[model samples]
Target chain A: MPVIEVRDLVRKFGDRTVLNGVTFSVEKGETMIIMGGSGCGKSTLLRHIIGSMKPTSGSIKLFGEEITTMPAPQLEQLRLRFGMNFQFGALLQSLTVGENVALPLVENSRVDPAIIDLIVKMKLELVGLTGFENLKPAEISGGMRKRVGLARAVALDPELLFSDEPTSGLDPIMTAVIDRLTHDLTRKLDMTAVVVTHDMVSAFRIGSKMIVLGAGKRAGTIIAQGSPDEIRNHPDPEVRQFINGEPDGPVPLKLSPEDYIDRLLGHPRQKGVAY
Target chain B: MTLRAELRTFFFLNREILRWIFLGPFQGRPVRTAAVFRQMVRIGVQAFPMTALTSLSIGLTLAMQGAQELSRMGASAYVPNLVAVTILRELGPLLVGVVVIGRSGSAVTAELGTMKVGEEIEALEVMAINPVRFLVVPRFLAMLVMLPVLTVFGDYIGLAGGWTICHFAMDMGTATYIQRLMEAGHPLDLYSGMVKSFVFAWLIILISCQSGLGVSGGAEGVGQATTSSVVTSILAMLVANAVLTAVFFVF
Candidate 1:
């Protein structure tokens, strides 16, 4: 059975619809990447799957159970099975990196502190955050913060993981490093991973399956969904244009004049080059 | 539609609120001194000048008004009694409470609101920690303990300011002002002021933290929560003070 199933998910803010009739599924042990432009509802969709936001109308099943409508306690119980690496890392500023990584084990599990310490160190080592556990989030570099967040996300050995823009604000080299780490963790643990990212490179590097959001706005629909090769060769003009970084495409319709001109004049746009 | 369902929902929310109160502030078992010290600096020390200044001005203004009115009635000697009673019983605690509601209250809301918007709160949830129990409780405890202490300080400064004005500015004898102050009212009036300070403390922390954690948007959301926190806490304090006054005096 699919590990996650989303159907007819519709979300709106005031009169502006963000997601409309979006649907997809991810199998166990697979990495599914949701790709879109800014405001295309990729993050919104991820929030929906995580039960952080209520869909206007839709259904979401995690492990064949309808988790969308689950109560807080039940949803919390369900959350234990999965972990999330936030875009900004979101490690508690007050805690040391070691404490931040050990948070999951400390709060949710009965594991001994010694074991948790060992595991936290091991996870940090895996993400190249070794020996820096004593530092707080503010004391670390941005790239290191993301790694610590990743370590914390996998702290409980979660069977599933969700990362929102994991490579955001990092150098390309760091982005590649994070991408490799994510791929290695998923393969080694055999865990299903869902990543919402706009970075085409990172997405292609890690995504086994991909969902492309936004065609003409007005509640972005899934314009395309398939494997990396299939997505690169997607028949939809919107998908192709988005991947190729074209100037005149489905995206320019919503762009500000400055953004349009910046792109047209080849003034480096801060392309959503993030995980 | 069922009573059972409604009750169940109510209890769940109530538990969440309680958990936030008890567990939120100490999440990660934050070192008490560090957190309390931060709050003390923020809520207690930083608030002192404003509290002192506002209370002093209020004292001076009250004495001036009291002297003017009592002088008209040829009872100018009652100025000290009036100032002592009003300052000790009401304005001292109440003015400090309002100032805190603006200062510490808005700050708590903005800080927590930013954390909520940034997903720091959710990250805590995923770690199996209750954000409320760990983060909110300590702050609640700190505010509850500190407000009364600050109120007492404000009351003393207010009385001193009032005394200085009456003795030097109003051409009143120090002995007369001192005597009137001593015979003004019962000790219970001052005790009630301290008690009200505690309630006002809870009101500040509760409203600010709740509004902060309730934030949904990004930075803009934190701003909105801060504004709402000051407005709500001040209003709540006013209503609470009136009720407390009535209960203390009428009953």
Candidate 2:
């Protein structure tokens, strides 16, 4: 059985649907990457998998337990087995980097203070932030913050890990560093990772299986899903365009809030309008 | 959002905050007593000077004006009674509440609202930490413990301001003022103000927290939430004050 299975997942925010009938599964020890453009529901799908969001109508089974309708305590218990790294570091502003990494251990477990301190040091060391643990997140660079987030996420040694745009807003070198960390941690820990990113290079580098989410009319569905090499050579134009980073493709530029609303409400084309 | 939805969110958060306050320690590992105390020092100790200064000025103004009117009507002897009762029962709680709402309540909203917008709240959720229990409970408990104490302290300082005016400015003599205050000062009057301050503190924190958690967008949203926190809290405080006064004193 897959470690994470989501079937017929539908999430609606008012009149608009974000994740529509999305179906996917991540087997144990496999790095499944969910790659999509902005507003393509990649993060939404991640939220559902972590049980932070309830689907409008669907079934999500985490470790063979149907989590869609699970009680609050049970869902919280399931979340313990899962770790998530957000887009930004999202570390507590008031805390030092060491405190931020140790938060999960301090809050959820009964570990001794000395052991927790040891674990915090080890995790920060793994992320190349050993001596800088006392520094606030604001005191560090963005790349360091992302590394700290990764350290915090893995503090519990979770069975499954998730990341949302881990290398976003970083230069090429930092991006490579984060991608290497993700791959190394997954392999060393024998952990299943589901990552969401629009960075094609990072996705291909770390992903064992890649699912490319479509945009515009085909927004929520998986346009293509395969190995990184297979996705690199996928026949679909949307997949080709996204992977190749083309500006002009089947994806139309939504310029304004009014345009988005028009698309959402399905406005009819203007009569006799010039293209 | 509509009024119904906003109110629903407000009350729902209130229920959740109260649950975390009373029941969370029993259910979870243990309450973070240190965090609560830290919040008390921030919310309580930091506001002492501002509360003292503002309430003092208000008392002096009230006494000066009351003395003028009483002297005109040859009822100047009633000035001490007027300042004692009014400041103890009314302005003490209201002024302190408004000041705290302006100071601490807005800060709470902005702080938590920024956390919400930054995905810090989402990060907490992923870690199986209840944001309300971790964030709001400490501030809520602090406000509960401190607002009443400030109100009572404010009553004393305000009475001092009245005394300063009567003794120095009016030459009414400290003995006469003390005698009037002794005759007029009832524990029930102070109790009513304490009760009102407590209720006002709860309202301020509840509204501010709800605003914080409900924030979205970005910096603009944080500013809007902070403003709304102050406005909604003051309005609720006024309405609550009227209701409590009628319930405790009028009936």
Candidate 3:
């Protein structure tokens, strides 16, 4: 069975449909990368799959068990099998790095304190943050905080990992390092990963399967999906524009001048006029 | 958010907190006592000096004013009775509640608002850790226990302030002052104030935490939520105090 499956997931905020009939699945040990421009519902989709959000319609299954309507206790039990690394690191500011990494283990298990400490050290070392465990999250650089977040996400050796823009703010070298760590974690530990990122470099480096979500008219629907090479050679011009970092593309950067003027003047759109 | 929506969210959050505190232990998820102790220090012990100063000031002012007014009627000896009845029955708990709302309640709102904005709450959720259990219950438990304790201390300090004025300004003997205070206060007076403090604690924590957890946007949102939390808590406490006072004394 696939490790994770989402079918016909639709999430709407009032009349604005953020995600429209989205569907995807990830098999065990496969790394699926979801790439999209800002406000394209990448994070929202990830939240639904992880059970943090309830879809307006459709189904999601984790480990062959339906999770979309699962009870809170059951969903929490399912959550123990996976880990999510948020975009901003989201480390509890009051906690030391070691305590932050050790949180899940200590809360969920009856492990000895010494053993938990040892495990925390090992996790920190995995992210190249050894001996820095005593410092609070605010003491670390943004890149270092993200690394600590990654370490904490994997602290439980979870079977599935969901990362949201893991390398967005990092320098090139740090980005490469994070990408390498993610690659190593998946390859060596046989873990399944679903990563949401727009960093083309990191996406190409670690993504075995890739999906590009559309913006503007396309909105939340996937515009392209396949292996990394398939996405690289996609016939879709929008996909090409996104992957190549082109400034000009089918992607709408701003509203038309007429629409902007109408919005500024608090006037409804004229009848029979295209947005 | 609409008032109806906000009210719904507040009640739902309260139910979740109650469930986590009462039922979580049976499900092998107990409230961490260590965190509760830590919050107690932050919420109660650290607010000690401020609580002390405020209670003393209120007590001293009450005595001085009561003496000045009663002396006009040649009933200056009734100053002890006035101070004792008022402090034990109302001002002690009310003053401490306001102090805590200012000191610790706003702090909880700002802390949780920042966490919500930064997605730390979501992170906790994804880790299978209920944020209500991990965060709110500790503050709830700490405030529930400490508010009453602080009120008791404040009541005594207020009585002491009244005693100081009685002894020096009124030229009344300390024994006479204590006797009048004892005669004026009933056991029900202290109990009524304790009941008010308990209710105020619940109001402060629930309002502050709900505002914090409901925060959106960013830094400015945190600031707005904290301000709202403080204002709502004080209003709720005042309303609750009036209701409880009527229940105990009038009805």
Candidate 4:
């Protein structure tokens, strides 16, 4: 059985539906990537999977237990089995990187201080952040912060981990660095990971299975779900265009009537072409 | 959830408050001393000057009013005693409460609200640190500890201002005014003021910390929480003062 199972999940913000009847599951050790545009509900779906937000309908099962219907105390207890890396790194700004990394050990477990220190150092070193544990989040570069977040998420050796926009503000090289660290951690630790990202390159690097979310009425419906190469070569024109970064495609930019007319006049269309 | 769950949450929140206070002694773990101290200084120390100035000015005004009223009855000598009792018992405690609500109360709310928005609180929870115990308790302890000290300072400055105004401006004998103030004000009266100060401090911290933890939405949510903290603290302080006054006077 999958470690995490989300079935027909739905969420709406007032009149607008952000996630519309989405269903997916992450197996025990699979690195699944949820990919989409800015408002495509990838983060929303991730939130539900992590039990941060309640679904409008359907159910979420974590480790074969129905989480949505569990008591608050039980749910809190169940939360320890999972870890999440926020989009902005979300490391406690007031704490040193070491403190941030050791927080889970300090709070959740009664491990020895010596052991915690060793584990914290090891986790930071794994992310290539050795000896920089004394530095605050502000002192580190954005990519380093993301790495620290990854270290913290894996601090307790959780079976399932979720990362939201892990490469949001990093340079391309740094993005790859974070992506590789994530890929290496999952592979080496034999852990399950669900990553949400818009960076196609970073997504392709670590995503064993990728799910794409589209817009509007089908906001969170999986437009495509397969291996990276399979998604890149999808038969769906919308998926193909998005993958290739094409300007003129099935996903047309909505323009005002005056601007639409201007575009038509500025670049004279073929005689038989429709506006 | 049932009523039992609500009750459990209440007790849990209270226990969390005490946990943070006790945890302060064990500095081996990550201690947010600098942050707490900075917040206390910003909320308590920086607010001192304004509280003093307001207290002195208001004390002077109260003395002036007392002089005018008592003079009509040929009891102008009573003005010093009236102002002394008023400053130590009512004005000092109440004014400090209001100042803290504006200064520290709103600050606690905004800080916690931003932490909520940034998911720092949730991160703490996932790390198995109870956010209420980790964050709210320290703030609550700081405010509770500082307000009484600040109130005493405010009372001293206020009485001195009243003495100065009565001695010089109101044309009363300095020695006589001091005699009346010392004779009329009891140690019990001072005790009442101190007690009220502690209660007000608790109210300010409780309202601010609770409102902050209650924050939802985004940045706008934080702003709303800050406003709510101030308003609620002020209201709670006022009600607590009234209750304390009734107990002190009636009983």
Give model 1's docking category. Answer: acceptable
Model 2 fnat? 0.76
Tens digits of lDDT, candidate 3, A1-275: 99998899899999999999888889988899999888999999999999989999999999999998899989988899998888888999999989999999999878999999999999888778999989999999988888899998998999999999999899898788889888988998889999999899899999999989998899989999899999999999999999999887798567878878798879877779776
Candidate 1: misplaced stretches above 4 Å? Answer: A93-99, A110-121, A130-144, A217-219, A248-275, B1-15, B19-41, B56-80, B126-128, B163-182, B216-221
Better of 1 and 2 by DockQ: 2
Over the full model, what C-alpha lDDT does candidate 3 score relative to the true structure? 0.92
Candidate 4: residue A75 lDDT (0-100): 76
Alpha carbon RMSD to native, model 4: 5.5
Specify the highest-lDDT model's number. Answer: 3
Best by TM-score: 3
TM-score (0 to 1) for chain B of model 1: 0.86
For model 4, what is the alpha-carbon lDDT of residue A210? 84
Per-residue C-alpha lDDT of model 2 across residues B1-251, encoded as one tens digit per residue: 99999989888888888787788778864667889999898888899999999999988998999999999999878878898889888899999999999989998999999999988999998899989889999999999999999998899999999999899988888998999998988888888899899999999988989999999999999999999889999999999988988897664
Enumerate the candidates' DockQ scores in order.
Answer: 0.46, 0.69, 0.82, 0.50
- Pick by DockQ: 3 or 4, better one: 3
- Candidate order, TM-score descending: 3, 2, 4, 1
**lDDT, residue A33, model 4:** 91
lDDT by residue (tens digit), candidate 3, B1-251: 99899899989998999998889899899999999999999999999999999999999999999999999999999998899889998999999999999999999999999999999999999999999999999999999999999999999999999998989988999999889988999988999999999999999999999999999999999999999999999999999998998898674
Better of 2 and 4 by DockQ: 2
True contacts kept of 3: 0.88
lDDT of 4 by residue, B18-108 (tens): 6556763573434456656766787788889888888888788888898889999999889889988999889989987888789778988
* Candidate 2 pairs with clashing backbones: none
Worst lDDT run of 10 residues, candidate 3 chain A, spans A252-261
